[model samples]
Target: MDSQKKFWRSLWQLRVPNKIKHFMWKACNDALPTKENLHRRHVMDSTTCDLCREHLEDTIHALWLCKDISCVWSSLEWFHQAILVQPANFRELLARFRPCQDEYKVEIFVIAAWCVWNRRNALHFNRVVSLVTSICREAVFRASNVAGVGVIFRDNRGDPIGAMSMPVPFGQSMVEMEALACQRAVQFALEIGLTRVVVIEAFLNGSGQLASFENILGDIRFQAACFQHVEFNYISCACNSVADALAKKASSALVLQEWLEDLPDDIAPLVFREVH
Candidate 1:
């Protein structure tokens, strides 16, 4: 286990440069499963998808490919070039997703997924099934015209890191943007050759008691696994503001990928764009 971890750390260090990036890769407190979680997994019921009986009613089928969803894709020509989206479960689907290097594509993918999720919720709560073509068209349009996006990450100081001021086509909830920041932070850590990290997020959904699991973070499972290593903490808005601003910076300039340098002029106008 130690050797395997070492390999991951080296990789992360190569990807990230700052202490905040390291924290994301080095401390993953969210990964720890509690008795409640372990107990629930043991009760997983049989029978595949409620909608699609053939396959397991898991994340991948519901999000990536389903009979009902195909109509949407066909109408919208979503997979125009033929890139398969086959995920066994929701986690797998997210794991398999590689954010498009193309800013436009990336924005589209994120918004599309969120839309799909929202549509699903509407179906569950309001009995509304969205038009597949509509979803696809909206996905493309929203992605391209995204006014801004948010990216969150954490630093060694147990501080939340994020951005929230890029002009995007649509609006992103603070929670959604924070999750993006966490993902990006882990990616940066991976680039600098670090394996483990602690990502501090100020999320109402987070579980934990004042700082421990089962209090603040609501999606402990996601917050934990997304990073190679991670830790979750509840932070005051005052401390979290800096990170949120950073996410806005990254989102504002979707056209440019200014990976490591002073943020480009487009992204710089927003607060907290600097990553050094």
Candidate 2:
């Protein structure tokens, strides 16, 4: 009981976003909407995981043990230590990190778990599975501030055709930065003489009621009309590593960067991973 209390205390003290803390709380309490919980409530007919279909979908299995989600954890350097001890539940899995001195690793674990849950939901609903590298990149993105924008243009074969990265002014919200990125991507597409374009965004959920977000999205829509055919698809950050990497690169770059068919050394690996 004291350990449980200690867990709660440490959880609230962590520096992660409140939404992540709330998610951790739900996970610890088994209050998450996992298929097992949904089955108990008659909300879902099967407790089997939709992603793996090999085991019952509980908080632990969904977040940690699922084969599909396990790669996200395995790809992390610190996760090797955490994975040594088999956790019986989500709370136990988190508890392993609680005593660790490095708070950043704790934050990564929490955020990655949350992202895995999100990916599970996305796959369940949309049938889109994000790559392991994208999930890892997203964990880093959430922990940092928005400093720039990145855009990558890919062919229907998922080969890179062009890319751009640019530093932007700080102090704007993430949604605003995402909006700016979308605008820049549209402009990039137009400048390259691409008529039919597809914009895959990791943000820009279109649910933001903020006036600034609405205005920027409106501008993007207006600019998109310039294309003969354009489609905007929303995927979670778990599928946007190449652009995320470029944005991270642009955050430190002094000037706008662009590329033709050849991608930079750093981004080429990401695109290759996505293509294969």
Measured by lDDT, the strongest candidate is 2
lDDT, candidate 1, equals 0.45
RMSD of model 2, in Å? Answer: 7.4
For candidate 2, give the lDDT of residue 233. Answer: 90
Expressed as tens digits, the lDDT of each residue in 198-254 for candidate 2 is: 899866574553585677778888889899999889976558889987987886564
TM-score, candidate number 2? 0.55
lDDT of 1 by residue, 167-227 (tens): 4344334444344444444455555554576655555453322233222234545445655
TM-score of each: 0.34, 0.55
- Where does model 1 exceed 4 Å of error? 1-46, 74-99, 146-276
Worst 10 residues of 1 by lDDT: 27-36
**Alpha-carbon deviation at 179 in model 2, angstroms:** 13
